[model samples]
Target chain A: MKAVPAASTVEVDGEYRLKREGTSLQWNIADESALEAALRLKDGDGIVTVLTMGPAKLEAALKELLARGADRAVLITDRRMAGADTRATAAALKAAAEKTGPFDLILCGRRAIDGETGQVPGELAAALDILCVSNVERLEKTETGMRLFRRTENGVQELEAAGPLVVSMCEYAYHLRLPGILSMRRAKSKTVEILTADDLELKTGECGLKGSLTKVITMEAKYPGLRKGPKETDLSKATEQIQAMLREVRP
Target chain B: MKEILVLCPHGVDGGLLSKAYALSEGNLRVLVLEGEEQTAEGYGAKYIHTIKTTPPDEAAFAGWLAEKIQSWGSTIVLAPATIAMRNIMPMLAWKLNAGLTADCTALDMAGEDLLQTRPAFGNSLMASIRSLSTIQMATVRPGTFRPVEQKANEPEIIPESGPAETGKVRELSFTEFAGGKPLSQADVIIAGGMGVGSKEGFEKLAKLASHLGAGLAASRSAVDAGYAPFRCQVGVTGVTVCPRLYIAVGISGAVQHLAGMSGSEKVIAINSDPKAPIFGYADYGYVGDWETIIDRLLHLEEETL
Candidate 1:
């Protein structure tokens, strides 16, 4: 999850730079919602550990999660793991999770704003050999097991599953809560366990671009289309502009 | 001729069928799940292997397809990008020790090699992927390619009838929301974003949408804020629409949100932030508060009506 100053964000170029040099990371809104979903389900039980795979710079991001009620944080950062596609990325994360587990449920954002693949959770679930439920809007504790309300293209689907499952939360469920002074204090003193590929027993060939199935060969700017005149701020003029256009296009 | 296996769960997947036809040099065996053989053939499926089962579970369905592909000697595997299939394709690929590229928007052949290109990084980049394994697998992006009718070409239909092997996952209860026009087919849509302010703000959007005979949608921000429902959220995580007219209200147009609905013929964006990225993509932009602009638009629409 990589969030940055909205105004400074630029399009990814051949250099594959996500953000400008001076830009810093913040909370990815969707993943924040996911953390909230996980915290609600954990509910005063179980250690809700936040796991992420990125550079050492993302250590601050993991610490930010701690302030949001994540009990512990683990960051897997290795030069060998750079440019790993979804499958290989999951392979490394799977190694990290195994170290953090025997867990009940593994939760993630429905889709990362950057990748937008919405594939890692399923691939990771397959790696962990567990049931993967995605787009979960709401989850409540039931006597037998947990009940999940999954948001789909049509509507919502209700599902019941036992523990040791992987789930991705729908952004519509709940936004992440703000960190109070006490939580912020806790986060300051906490240390994020930074692990390398060697620690995870991941080989260089199996963790990065060398192991990934996909490769980004080209990145071109999208073609610009019909541009109406400069933005009109005057209410009366804007309304007239819209009305005139509507009239011209009226069937 | 090469034997290619295409997983067609829906009525017919035009993209996969067309790609399979070209790849196989006219040899295609469509492994369908509760599909019509006649319809599959119309998409140029020379052979349709229907997997008959009760609401086929993905795990079981993938297992069955893997077996069929192995025995049938089809080296190329194609699946349409669906939620279930997205999960299944990776598992199948892993099981077979193969390479898979999901949501491929383009496919081509280079000598004996198959090339697949899919969008990556919020539609900012295109990934050209190929598999080194014996079996090449790809999940085709839905609705990217047009369906060509091959009425005269009849398929050899092999219906594998009976209940499929049970898997760990079971069918769950599905509930459709209070009906609204499906975004996929909506001709006109009025969508709001984080800047829309609140749930009440969305009510304003809905009113304008109703007046214009358009569907109502929202960005992930509005949906997360409880201003709109998840089903109404238009983005990577929700619906991909190409509505004729897409009116974006208070949207900053994050690349994540724009990727879904950028295909609109006409886009009108209303936002107070004059420097907003959305202005770059919209055909028309009104730099003002959405409430103010929407109010005027609503009044104008009412007067016209």
Candidate 2:
């Protein structure tokens, strides 16, 4: 039983890159343990395509994916798609995914550090009209479908979902791989196809501000320079003050 | 003249009404839309419209509210920055062609413009944004305003009648957790976090809270670690508490947690980490082991009583 390349990288050019040294391809950005687990389930025949949406600034993130073992990379970028909110961003990404054709599975970080709304992957799942398994920690390839272990409030729960599903990686999902010098150099020379709005034929309104449903009406300073005087910290006096404050509430 | 409509979710809790009334002085006339049960009189408001809707059909309720706003001839609208208000605000704002700012901690009358303040970028940065459109909107966080108190019973409560639309989502079932004494309502709150070490540690904290009659709260990490239920969590994803005396026990004080409870009247942090962010916001911070400190506090409470 050959181990699969359980790690694939999505590049800025919207291509999936997998390491040639590995057989099975893993599709998560975080959690190397989960990636190794994913490799164990593969027969070493799957192709890993790195997919990403953004300008060339995301090239580094994509190259890192390649170093981790993605077979190829795909970059989806367009000037018209700047300043997109989550809904429009999901729409554009879904369009790019449709253009690149199909896949047995799609994976994404549960949420981006920027705009911690955690709405993109859910919105993307809705846009693509697929089954979404959020916060998946492990994946096991099965004969008919895939088995996944997801984090829940109480504990980890297992679920079986058919292929062609989207899984959002949680905080503890998988550890991100470190890109070796050799893999980093090789990723630089790798071919990454950059797809624009024209390539996806996305409507102008559906790509950026026009397609976004939410808008920021106003922004204001929350905390200015601290105005409160320094606190008195005599332990006995502070305890008395706290007790006095508590009494005022009940009374 | 450009007008902004504000939906007072709690219908001017006297505390909030006075603040809105103060902010609406001069050319700004705050048209407060509230529930029919809420009294609108004595707030010095130019106009008051009360909405009629029950819980469980808020989407339809929002559509109805949007329709009323559409006919009200207002360019911008605002809502109280409460959890219930936020649930329907975005959809209503979207329908009204207006933008919305959630959890605005501060708002000001900037000449002809309205400046809103909110914590952004993981609460590390504060952003002050001014909307270009005439019909800009935002939801102000509660307690952000200092409500002016005055004795005047009769302001006005106008009852509104309209055809409610069908809603997209249906309420299947709901469970209401007994929230104990809400931190906002409590004068003293004893909050625990993951740094407490174990469930036994949390029990000790609870014993201290019991002795002091303070409400028990937990940080997100504590809740995530199963030390406490989600309802007891205090952070951005949980409840915003403004207790008079907040006793933070063994909490590392992540920014998200700080954003929710920083407005407390006074914060006393008990954590071993001298460099913990909680210390920065604490009125008094004890840099020592929580176990020993909690045990001592409990003993002192018993002996003093």
| Top-TM-score structure, candidate number | 1
Off by over 4 Å in 1: A1-8, A11-20, A43-45, A180-189, A223-251, B1-3, B22-25, B53-57, B161-167, B185-215, B219-227, B235-239, B244-257, B265-305
| TM-score for all models, in order of appearance | 0.80, 0.63
> Candidates' interface RMSDs, in order?
4.3, 8.6
TM-score attained by chain A of model 2: 0.71
Candidate 1, A127-236: lDDT as tens digits: 88776777778887777666888765556778776656777776546778778688889889899998899999888889888878766655544423335537777777
Tens-digit lDDT track of model 2 for A1-251: 00112312211111212123423343332333434344344466875666777666556656666776665778888888876765677778788788776777777665443243444554565566555655556677767677776643224556566546666655444455567777677777887778887888888887777766555554333431222333443555545655565566654
lDDT for each residue of candidate 2 in B93-182, tens digit (9 for 90 to 100): 545555455666677776666677766533434666566444666777665565564444444456676435433222333333343454
Docking verdict class for candidate 1: acceptable
